[model samples]
Target: MTPEEILPDDLMERIRGRAAGYDQDNSFFHEDLAELAAAGYLKVFVPVPDGGLGLGLEAAAALQRRLATAAPATALAVNMHLVWTGVAHVLAARGDDSLGFVLKEAGQGEVFAFGISEAGNDSMLFDSGTTATPEGDGSYSFTGRKIFTSLSLGWTRLGIFGKDAAARNGDGELVFGFIGRETPGHETLTDWNTLGMRASQSNTTLLQGAVVPPERIFRKLPVGPNQDPLVFAIFACFETLLAAVYTGIGERAFTLALEAAKHRTSAKYGGRSYAQDPDIRWKIAEAAMAMDGIQPQLASVARDVDALVDHGPQWFPKLVGLKVRATENARAVVDIAVRVSGGSSYFRGSELERLYRDVLAGIFHPSNEESAHSTVANAWLGPLEM
Candidate 1:
C-alpha cells in the first residue's frame, strides 16, 4: 500500500494543523491518536488475516517517514505501538510465534507502548533497574520506574522488563512482559513537559508491584548481552522506525528550505530570489546531498531486515550506524534549512524552529552518538584491551 493510503493527506493536514497547538500546550496528540486508531494505523505490522495491512518493515518505515513529515510528535508517539507489532511480525516470520498475541491485539484496536527505557540504565536491554519478583502462582510483580514512555496517555498495553535478581543462580535474569494500563500498582506521572516532541507526552511511569500473568511474560534471558532473537527483533524495529521518523523531519525541513529559496528575495542581490544566490543554492545543495546519502542506507537496512538477510555480529553496527547517520544528517539538514530560511526561522512560531527542536531529540534516543560510535568501533576492532 502507498503512504497516501496509509495516511491520507487530509488527515495529515489536520494533524499538522494541530501540531503547533499541541506543542504550545504541552499536550498529547489525542486527536491524532484517535484518527490513527480509526484508520487502523496501529495494525500496520499485523498479519492480513488479523485485519491489518500486513506490510513489511520496509513499507512500514516508509509510511512512518511520511507521517512524520506532517506531524513528527504524532508519528514518534505512534512508533512505540508499531514497534511492538513489528516485533511480533518479525518473530512470527522467523518461525517463532511467541509475540503473535501482539499482532492479534493490535488488530483488535489495542494500543501497545514501550516501557523499556529507565533512568541511568545505560545497559539498555542487557540490564534493568526494575525488579521482577516471581510469585508461586506463575505471575510476576514488577517494581521500578520507567522513563520516556511514549503514548503514556492512551496505551492499553505496555511492554516492560526488569531484572530477576534471584534467577539463574544470582547471575541475574532479564524478564520481559506486557501489563495492562488498568493493572494495579502502576502510575503515569504527568511530567512530560519538554523542549521538543511535546505532543508525544512521554511521561515518567512508576510501577509498584504491577503483576504480569505467566502467559504475558515473554522473554527471559541472561543479564548481559547475548545472541537472542528477541534482542534482534527489538533493535531491528526500534532503530529502523526511529530513523524513518527523523528522515521525515529532515525531508520536510529540506522541502521548506527549497520553497524558501524559491520565494525569498535578497535585497543585496539585485532584488533576486535567494534561489538565484550562489551561496543560498550551495546551502540547499549541501543539505540535499547529505539527506540523499542517508536515504539509501536507511532504505537498504530496513529492506534487509524484512528480507532476513543476516549481517551476523555486524547487525548491531549497521542498525546503530543507520540510526546515527539518519539522525545526525537530519540535524545537519535542519541546520542548513534554518540558515537558508534566514532569521525568521529562529522565532518560536516558525515551523523550522519546531523542527530544529525535534531533530535535536534524535541524538538522545537509544544507540545515541556515543553508544553508536562505540558499537561501530567494537564491531571493527573488537572489544577494548581493558
Candidate 2:
C-alpha cells in the first residue's frame, strides 16, 4: 500500500462511529479488529523474520498514540498483545527457543492473553490459589479459578502462570503455560461487568482439572539458575502504554467538552452562549492546560522506550520510573476530563462517560502507582535485589 493507503483514512472515522455504540452494538467489533490484525497492526512490532512487518517501536508508539484518540478500548485490548507479544518476541529473537512457536503463531493473528491477576491471592501472584501440579506424564493438572481474565473466551491461548512444580532446593519459579482456551475443562463466565470499557468483555475463566501439556509451556524453569531481566522491563513498557491510553482519553474528553460548551446555550438570566459563561470557559481552559502539560512527558517516555532497544537491561528501572510518573499523569488527565464535562457527562451515552471508564482501566493495571513506585525504589536503593 502507498502512503495514502498506509493508514486507511477511514480507520479513525470508523472507530469514531463505533465509539457511540461500542458498549451496546458492534458486538465488540470482533470483525473490525480482525481486519486490523490482518493489516499487520496486531503484529506491528514482531520481527520480519518471524513473518511480521517489524515496524519497530517508534512506529508502534506513533500508532499507539493515534489509535488511543479514536477507539481507546481497541487500543486497550490491543495493548495486551502489543506490549507483551512484542517483548516476548524480542526475547524470542535472542534465541529463547521455547517462545519461537508462540511468536510465529502471534504473527499469524494468533491471540493470547496474560492471566496474572486472580482472586484471594492477597495481591501476590506466586501465592495464588491456582496451582498446576505435575501429573508425572509431562502434563500438569491446573486447578483453580482466575478472575478478570480479560479476553477470556475469545483468546486462542491463555498465558497461565503457576508455581513451578520441579523445584529441587525449594526456591520455586513462575512457569508460564500457553493453555488452549477450548480445552474441555476450561470454561469462561462473562457474568462480570465494569463501570467502563464494557467491550473489554473481561470475564472469569474457570479451570477445574484443566490439563496442560508440557508443549504449551512458554517460559519454563530458570535461565541456568538465574531469572530473566526482560520480564520486569516488559512490564514497565505495558504500564507506559496504559498511560498513553489514559492520556488519549483525556484528550477526547477535552475535545468533546469544547465542542459541547461552544454550542450550549446558557439557561439562566437571559440566554447567553454557554461558551460565554466565565466559569465554564475557565474550566475548559484549565483542562486544556492540564492536557498540554502532560503530553510532553508522554512523548519523552516514548522516546525512552526507543532508547531501551539500545540501552539493554539497564533501562528496566528507567522505564519503571516512566510508568510510575505517567500513570498518575493519565489519572490526572481523566479527572480533569470528567470535571470539565460536568454532570451531564455522567449520562450513559456520553463520550466522556466511556472515556472516563476506559481511563480507569489504567489505574487497575498490575503496575499501578504503588507497584511501580516500589519496583523503581527497590531497583534504585535496595540492599538485596528485587
Q: What is the C-alpha lDDT of each candidate?
A: 0.93, 0.66
After superposition, the stretches of candidate 1 with alpha carbons farther than 4 Å from their true spots are none
Model 2 lDDT per residue over 1-386, tens place: 23124346686777667766767552355754766776777777666887777654445655766677787877777776666676665555555555666667887778877666786564444345577777787777777788776665467877776665456456565666767756767778866567667666677888787877878765554413234645643554565676666667767777777877776677783677768888887878877787787677666666655554455434545565655555556556666656655688788877777777777766676655676666567666763444
Residue 214 in model 2: lDDT:
78
For candidate 1, the 10 contiguous residues with the lowest summed lDDT are 39-48
Tell me how far the alpha carbon of residue 86 in candidate 2 is from the true structure, in angstroms, after superposition: 1.3
Put down candidate 1 lDDT per residue, 231-300, tens digits, no spaces.
Answer: 9999999999999999999999999999999999989998889999999989998998998898898899
Error of 1 at 135 (Å): 0.8
